[model samples]
Target chain A: MRTAFIKSLMSLAERDPRVWLLTGDLGYSVLEPFAARFPERYMNMGVAEQNMAGTAAGLALSGKKVFTYSIANFAVTRCLEQIRNDICYHNADVTIVATGGGLTYGTQGYTHHGIEDIGFTRLLPNISVVVPADGYEVDLAMGSISGRSGPSYLRLARGGEPVIHTKPIDQSLFGRALMIRPASDVAILSTGSILGEAVAAADRLTAEGIKTGVYSVPVIQPFDAETVAALARQCSLLVSVEEHVTQGGLGSAVAEVLSGLDNPHARLERAGVVHGISPNAGSHAYLRQLHKLDANSLVERIRKISNLSAKRSVKIK
Target chain B: MTAATQTSTSLARRIRSHALRMTHAAKASHIGSCFSMADILAVLYGGVLRFDPSRPDWPERDRFIQSKGHAAAILYAALAETGFFPADWLSTYSCDGSRLGGHVTGHGVPGIELSSGSLGHGLSVACGMSLALRADKKASRVFTLLSDGECDEGSIWEAALFAGHHRLDNLVAIIDYNKIQSFGSVANVLDLEPFADKWRAAKWSVVEIDGHNHDALHKNIGHMPLEAGKPSVIIAHTIKGKGVSFMEGQLAWHYKSANDEQLAQALTEING
Candidate 1:
C-alpha cells in the first residue's frame, strides 16, 4: 500500500507541477522514487510533524498541492491542530498520507498503532477521510483526492497487501463502496486493509450455508449512505468492519446513519478494536486475532450475531 | 524621518486607537497583544508590503501572517487604514456574525494570508510560502508576526529550525517581544531569555530592534534577505498596551477589555 501511494503520488507530481511532497522523515525506502524524481518538490521535513503539517498547509495556500507523509499517528494525532486550523480551516490543497494504519505496526507497540486516526480525522470539517483497502484502492483514491481542492487524509497500510479486486475497478467508485459479494442474510461492510479479512470471512460464512455479502468502503467521510442503507434493508444483519477503533471509524459512521434512518430493517454490529490502548505487543496477525479482526474471528462473531438476531425475530413472530 | 516613516507612525497610532475601540465595543480581550505589534503591522501595510487594495489576491504580492492571532483588532485596523476594506468595518470587529473574528482569520478578510490564533503555526507556514515563491521564482516575500509569549510553543522552534535549514531567504519573522503571556510575564512563565541566540543557532540571520519604532521597522524589514541563503528573524522588543499610559506594561490588559471610562482615557492618551 505504501509503494502504491508513492507511485500514484509520483505520477500526480509528474503530471501537475503544483504537486509537492513533504515527509516527517518516516518514508525511507518507499519514498526514494519520488524524492529522486522530484528533488525540488520533495522535502524531508526532519522529525517535526507539526512543522511538516504547517509547511504543507503553507505550500498549499501558496497554490501548490501538498502531501505530508509520516507513519500512522505521527501524521494525524501529533499535528492535529495544524491539520484542523492550518489545512482544513483554510481549505488548503493538502493530502496527509498516514502509512501503517492500524495493527500493521503491531510489533512496534501501541505507540505506532493508528487505530484512532480515522476517529479524529473524520470529525474535522472540509477534509475527506479515505482509508484505501489495497494497492489498487490506493491508486483509485489518489485520483479522487488529488482532483479535489480541499484537504484529505489518506490512511494506508504498510506495503505488500494483496489487491483483492481481480476485475477492473472504476475510478467513479472512489468515494463509494465496491461490493465484492451480493447480500443474502447478512452483509459485512469493511474498510482499509481489513477488507481482505472481511472477504475471507464472507467466503467461510457462505460455505457454512449462511449466505453473506462483502462491500469495501474506501472513503469513510462523505460516506456512501445510499448503499449502506440499501444493504441494511436487504440484509437482516449489517456488520461494519475496520482495523480502526469502533468508536469513530467505519462502524461509528454506519451506526450514526442507521440510527437516524426511519424503520431501518437490519441490526448493526460494529467489529473492530475496542476502545483504549493495548499493552500487549505482537505481529500484525497476532494482534488482529486478539482483536477478533482476523477472518476466522470475524466469521465466528458474525455467525453468533446472525443466530441471536434470528432468535429475536422468531420471538417477535 | 522620511514621509513614509511619518505615515507609518500615524498609521500605528490609528491602529492602537481602533483596537481600543473595537475591543471595548465587542467586550473582547487581547488589546495588549494588539498594541504591541501595531507598529509592525503599520509599517508593513504602510509601505514595506507590495499589495494593491483592489487586488488582495495579487500573485506577486507579499504575504503577511499574524501568528499571534489574538491581535486581530490591530491587524484588521491596519488593513482598513491601508484601504483593504472600509475603515467603518472596524466597528464590527468580534461582533456576532462579523467577519472580524477575535482571532485573526482570512475567511472573508482581505490581505490576510493565513488564519491563526494558535501559537507557533505561522512561521512554518511562512516558510512554506517562502519555499513555494522561491520554487516559482517569484520575488514576493513572506512576513509573519509572532508574539514573545507565543514563542513558548514548541512548534515555533520546529518551524524556526525548518526555515533556517531550508535557507528560505524570502521569509522574514518579526517577533513581537512584549514579554507578557496569558498567565504571567514570559520570564515568570517560561523564559525565552536566550531568544535571539536560539534563532541564530537555527541558521537564521538575527536582528533585534524596538518593535514600536517605525524607522527601525522600515529600515530592517524594508530590506530583503538580511543575509544571502538564510531566513531572517527580527526580535522586535515591544511594550504591551503601548501608546496607552495606564495599560502599557500591565498584564491585566491581556485579558481585560477596556470599559467605557477606560476607553475614553485610552483614546485621550493615544491622541495626546
Candidate 2:
C-alpha cells in the first residue's frame, strides 16, 4: 500500500508543480524518488511532527498542495493541535498521510499502533478522514484528494496489502462503500485493511446457504450515509467490522446513521478491538485473531447474530 | 518608506483607543495582551510590511502570522486603519456575524495570512512560509509575532531550531516580551531567561530592543537578513498594558475587560 501511495504521489507531483511533500524524517527508502526528481518540492522536516504539520499548513497557504507523511501515531496524535489550528482552522489545502494505519506495525509495540487515529481525525471539522483498504484503493484515494482543496487525513496500511480492486477506480465512486459480494439477507460492512477478511467472510457464509452482502468503506468521515441508510433498509441484519476501536471508527459511524433513522428495522451489531489496548505484543494476524477480526471469527459472530434474529422473527410470527 | 507615514506613537494610541471601545462593548478579556503588542503592530503596519490592503492575497505580499492570537483587537485595529477593511468593522469586533472574531480568523477577514489562537503554531508556520519562498526564489519574507508566555511551548523551540538549521534568512520572529502571561509573570511561570543566547545558539541572529521604540523597530526590521543566511529574531522588551496607566504591569488586566467608566478613562488617556 505504501509503495502504491509513493508511485501515485510521484505521478501527481510530476503533473502538478504545486505538490510538495514533507516527511518527519520517515519514509526513508520510499520517498527518495520524489526527492530525487523534485528536490525543490520535497522537505525532510526532521523529527518534529508539530513543526512538520505547521510547515505543511504554511506551504499549503502559499498555494502549494502539501502532504505531510509519517507513521500513523506520530502523524496524527503527536501534532494533533497543529492539525487542528494550523491546517483545519485555516482550512489549508494539505493532506496528512499516515502510513501504518491500525496495527500494521504490530510487534514494534503499542506506541506504534494507530488504533485511535481514525476516531480523532474524524472529529476534526473541515477535514476528510480516509482509510484506504489496499494498494489499488491507495491509488484511487491519492488521485482523488491530491488535488482537492481543504485538509484531509489519509490513513494508509503498511505496504504489501492485497490488491483489492481489479481495475482503475473512479474518483467520485471511491468514498462510497464498494460491494465485494451482493446479497440481501445479511450485509457485512467493513473498513480499513479488514475488507479482504470481510470478502472471505461473505464467501464462507454463502457456502453455508446464508445470503450475505460484503462492502468496503474506505472513507470514514462524510461516510456514505445514504448507502448506509439504503443498506439498513434492504437487509434484515447488518454487521459492521473493522481493525480499529469500535467506539468511533466504521462501526460507530454506521451505528450513528442507523440509530437516527425513523425506526429502521435492520438489527445492528459491531465487531472490533473492544478489549482496549493489549498488554502483550503480537503480530498483525495474531492480533486480529485475538480481537476476533479474522474471517473465521467474524463468520461465527455473524452466524450467531443471524440465528438469534431468525429465532426472534419466528417467535414474532 | 524609511519611517512609517503614520507616526508609531499615534498608531499605537489609536490601537489602544479602538481596543478600549471594542473590548468594553464586547466585554472581552486580553486587553493587557492587546496593549502590550499595540506598539509592535503599529510599527509593522506602519510601512514596515510589503503589502497592499486592496490586494490582500497578492502572491508577492509579505506574510504576517500573529502567534499570540488573543490580541485580536489590536490586529483588527491595525488592519482596519491601514485600509485592509473599513474602520467601521472595528465596532463589529467580537460580535456575532462579524468577520472579526474574538480570536483572529482568516476566512473573509482580509490581510490575515493565517488564523491562530493556539500559542505555539504561528512561528512554525512562518518558518514553513519562509522555507517555501526560498525554494520558490521569491523575495517575500515571513514575519510572526509571538508572546513571551508562548515560549513555554516546546513547539516554539522546535521551530526555533528548525529556522536556524534551514537558515531561513527570509523569516523574522518578534517576541512580545511583556513579562506577564496568563497564570502569572512569565518569569514565575516559565523562565525564558537567557532567551537571546538561546536563539543565538540555535543559529539565529538575535536583536534585543524596546518593543515600543518605533525608530529602532523600523531600522532593525527594514534592514533584512540581519546576518546573511540566518533567521532573525527580535526580543522586543515590552510592558503588559503599556498605554493605560491603571492597567500597565497589572496581571488582572490579562483576564479583565474595561468597564464603562474605565473605558472612558482609558480612552481619555489614550487621546494624548
Candidate 3:
C-alpha cells in the first residue's frame, strides 16, 4: 500500500509541475523514487510535524498541490490544528498521507498505532477521509485526490498486503464502496486494509450454508450512504469491520448513516478494536486476534449474530 | 521628520484613533496590541508594501500576514485607510455578521493573506509562501508581524529554524516587542530577553529598532533581505497603548475596552 502511494505520487509530480512533497522524515526507502525524481519539489522537513503541515498549507496557498507525509499519528494527530486552521479552513490543495494505519506497526507499541486518526480527521470540514483497502484502491485514491482542489487524508498500511481486487479498478468508483460478493442472508462492510479479513470471513460463512456479502468502503467521509443503505435493505444482518477502534472509525460512520434511515431493514453489528490502549506487546496478527479483528474472530462473531437473529425470528413467529 | 515620516505618522494616528473607536463600540479588547503595531502597519501600508488597493489579488504584490491577530481593529483600520475597502467598514468591526471579527480573518475581507487568531502560525505560513514565491522565481516577498507574547509558542521556532535552514531570504519577520502579555508582563510570564540572539543563532539577520519610529521602519523595511543568504527578523521595541497618555504602558489596556469617556479622551490624545 505504501509502495502504491509513492508510485502514484511520483506520477502526479511528473505530470503537474505544482505538485510538491514534504515529509516529517519518516518515509525512508519508499519515498526515494519521488525524492530522486523531484529534488526541488521534495523536502524532508526534519522531525517537526507542525512545521511540515503548516508549510504544506503555505505551499498550497501559493497555488501548489502539496502532500505532507509521515507515519500514522505523526501525520494527522501531531499537527491537527495546522490541518484544521491552516489547511482545511483555507481549503488549501494539500493531501496528508499517513502510512502505517491501524495495527500495522503493532510490534512498535501503541504509540505507533493510528487507531484514532480517522475519527480526528473526519470531523474537520472540507477534508475527504480515504482509507484504501489495498494497493489498487490506493492508486485510484491518489488519482481522485490530486484531481480535486481541497484537503484529503490518505490512510495507508504497510506494503505487501494482499491485493483484494483481481482486475483493474475503475477510477470513477474511487469514493464509492466496491462490492466483492453479493448478499442474501448477511453482509459485511469493511474499510481499510482489513478488507482481506472480511473477504475471508465471508468465504468461510458461505461454506457453512450462511450466504454472506462483502463490500469494501475505502472512503470513510462523504460516505457512500446509498450503497450502504442498499446493502442494509438486501441483507438481514449488516456487520461493519475495520482495524480501528469502534467509537469513531468506520463502524461509527456506518452506524450514524443507518440510524437516520426511516425503517432500517438490517440489524447492524460492528467488528473493530475495543476502545482503550493495549496492554500486551505483540505482532500485527496477535493484536488483531486480541481485538477480534482477525478473520477467524470475525467469522465466529458473525455466526453467533446469525444464530441469535434466527432464534429471534422464531420467537417473533 | 521627512514628508514621508509625517505621512506615516498621520496614518498611524488614524489607525490608533479608528481602533480606539472600533474597540469601544464593539466592546472588544486588544487596544494596546493595536497601538503597539500601528506605526509598523502605517509605514508598510503607506508605501513600503508593493500592493495596489485596486488589485488586492495581484500576482506580484507583496504578502503581509498579521500573526498577532488579536489586533484586528488596527489591521482592519489599516486595510480600510489604505483603500482595500471603504473606511466606513470600520464601524462594523466585531459586530454580529460583520466581516471584521475580533481576531483577524480573511474569509470575506480583502488584503488579508491568512486568517489567524492563533499565535505561532503566521511565520511558518510566511516561510511556505516565501518558498513558493522563490520556486516560481517571482520577486514578490512575504512579511509577517508577530507579538512578543506570541513567540512563546513552539511552532514559531519550528518555522524560524525552517526559514533559516531553507535560506528563505524572501521572508521578513517583525516582532512587536511590547513587553506586556495576557496575564502579566512578558518578562514575568516568559522572558525572551535573549530573543535577538536566538534569531541570529538560527542564521537570520537581526535588527533592533523603535517600532513607533516611522523613519526607522521605512529605512529598514524598504530594503529587502538584510543579508544575501539569510532570512531577516526585526525586533521592534514598542510600548503597549502607545499614543494615549492615560493608556500608554498600561497592561490593563490589553483586555480593556474603553468606555465612552475613555474613548473621547483617547481620541483627543490621538488627534492632538
Q: Count the backbone clashes (under 3 Å) in each candidate.
A: 0, 0, 0
Q: Report how closely model 1 matches the true complex, as a DockQ value.
A: 0.90
Model 3 clashing residue pairs (backbone): none
Model 1 per-residue lDDT tens digits across residues B1-272: 89999899888888889999999999999999899888888899889999988999999999999999998999999999888999999999988899999999889898889999888899889989999999999999999999998888889999998889889999999999999999998998999989899999999999999998888999999997899899999999999999898989999999999999999999999988
**Candidate 2 residues B114-180, lDDT tens each?**
8988799999999888987887899999999999999999999989999999899999999999999
Chain A TM-score across all models, in listed order: 0.97, 0.96, 0.97
- Fnat for every candidate: 0.84, 0.74, 0.62
List the lowest-lDDT window of 10 residues for candidate 1 chain A: A308-317
Q: If ranked by TM-score, best first, what sequence of candidates would result?
A: 1, 3, 2
Q: What's the true lDDT of residue A119 in model 3?
A: 92
Docking class of 1: high
Worst 10 residues of 3 chain A by lDDT: A308-317
Q: Candidate 2's error at B88, in angstroms?
A: 1.2
Q: Could you give the C-alpha RMSD of every candidate to the true structure, in order shown?
A: 1.4, 1.8, 1.6
Model 3 agreement with the true structure over B1-272: per-residue lDDT tens digits: 88889889999999999999999999999999999999999999987899988999898999999999999999999999999999999999998999998999999899999999988889988988999999999999999999999999999999999999989999999999999999899999999989999999899999999999899999998897999889999999999999998788999999999999999988999999
lDDT by residue (tens digit), candidate 3, A70-174: 998999998999999999999999999999999999999888999999999999999999999898899889979878999999999997788999876998897
The regions of model 2 sitting more than 4 angstroms off are A275-277, A314-317, B1-6
Residue-level lDDT of model 1, residues A210-236, one tens digit each, is 899999999999899999988877778
Question: What TM-scores do the predictions have?
Answer: 0.98, 0.97, 0.98
